[model samples]
Structures are given as C-alpha cells and as structure tokens.
Target: MTPEERSLRARLAAHVSWAATPDPASRTAKARAAADSKFEREAREMHPDASDEHIARVAKHLRSAHFSRMALKAAARRRNSATPKAA
Candidate 1:
C-alpha cells in the first residue's frame, strides 16, 4: 500500500467500534474528535520543519474513513431490519 493509504489505515485502526455506534450524529462527533486529536498528536511527533499539508492530509484520510465506516454500518443495520425474521 502507498504511504498515504497506510497512514489512513493506521488512523482508522486507532479508533474502533465506531461502526457499532448507533446515533449518526454521535458517531460523527466522535470521529471528528478522534481525527482532530490524532492529527494534533501526529503533528507534535513530526519534525519541526513539517508542514500543515501533512496534517491536513492525515485529517482528511481519517474523516473519510470514519464516514465510510459509519455508512457501511448504517447500511448493514438497514438491511438487517428489512430482512424478515424466520418463524
């Protein structure tokens, strides 16, 4: 995997159980907070010469992954609900 993809996966892995979260709004808030925290931590760990672009890239990847996970969970819930229970 590319460096960007690996970084994104690491960020996503840091925050688990996100998909199991029931409320969309709550899940979004959680994701945002986690992303922001991770970004700041990463920035702090980077060399002083590092640029904002790197931090932004990480944040973007995290947010995108979070939403993707949330969407998948919501779809799964919908599908399960739609399926009739066996007698």
Candidate 2:
C-alpha cells in the first residue's frame, strides 16, 4: 500500500476506537432494565385480560420513565415565555 493509504487507515482505526468508548448513560439504563423488565412481566401477568393496544400504550409511557427530549423542549419554550427578557 502507498504511504498515503497507510496513514488514512491508521486514522480511521483510531476514530473507531474512540467512538466505541462505553457511555456511562448506557450503564444507567442497564441498571434500570432489570426493574423495568420485572414491571413489564408483572403487568402482563396480572392483566392478561387487557388488550394489546392498552398494554402497548402503558409500555410506551413506562419506557419513557421521565421527560423526553421533546417534552424538555416544550418545557423550555413555556419557561421562556414566562421569563422577562433583559434589556
């Protein structure tokens, strides 16, 4: 291979290594997953009579568990409207 090709390959390898770093947020999700899974299992078990659509709706809310990005943005907009601008 040419020197230019070798240099490009090394840079790409380094970028891939950096990108693969484990994000801490993923670990937090992993910790929460056990509890969340148990909740889902129990919900299905206790409400075997409930419709799939209802279960899916409840599951969506459960999955969010907190303010999502869109919700945050909407909140920010509301706060902005309530605040006075500085001169």
TM-score per model over all chains: 0.46, 0.34
lDDT measured at residue 61 in model 1 versus the true structure, 0 to 100: 71
1-87, model 2: which lDDT tens digit per residue?
A: 999999999999978876786875674687778766765666677678888776666665756754476798899999999999999
Angstrom error of the Cα, residue 20, model 1: value is 31
Off by over 4 Å in 2: 1-22, 56-87
lDDT of 1 by residue, 8-53 (tens): 9988875655556677787588877876888566654653566777
Per-candidate Cα lDDT values, in order, are: 0.75, 0.75
Q: Which ten residues in a row have the lowest lDDT in candidate 2?
A: 58-67
Q: Can you tell me which runs of candidate 1 are displaced by over 4 Å?
A: 1-35, 39-50
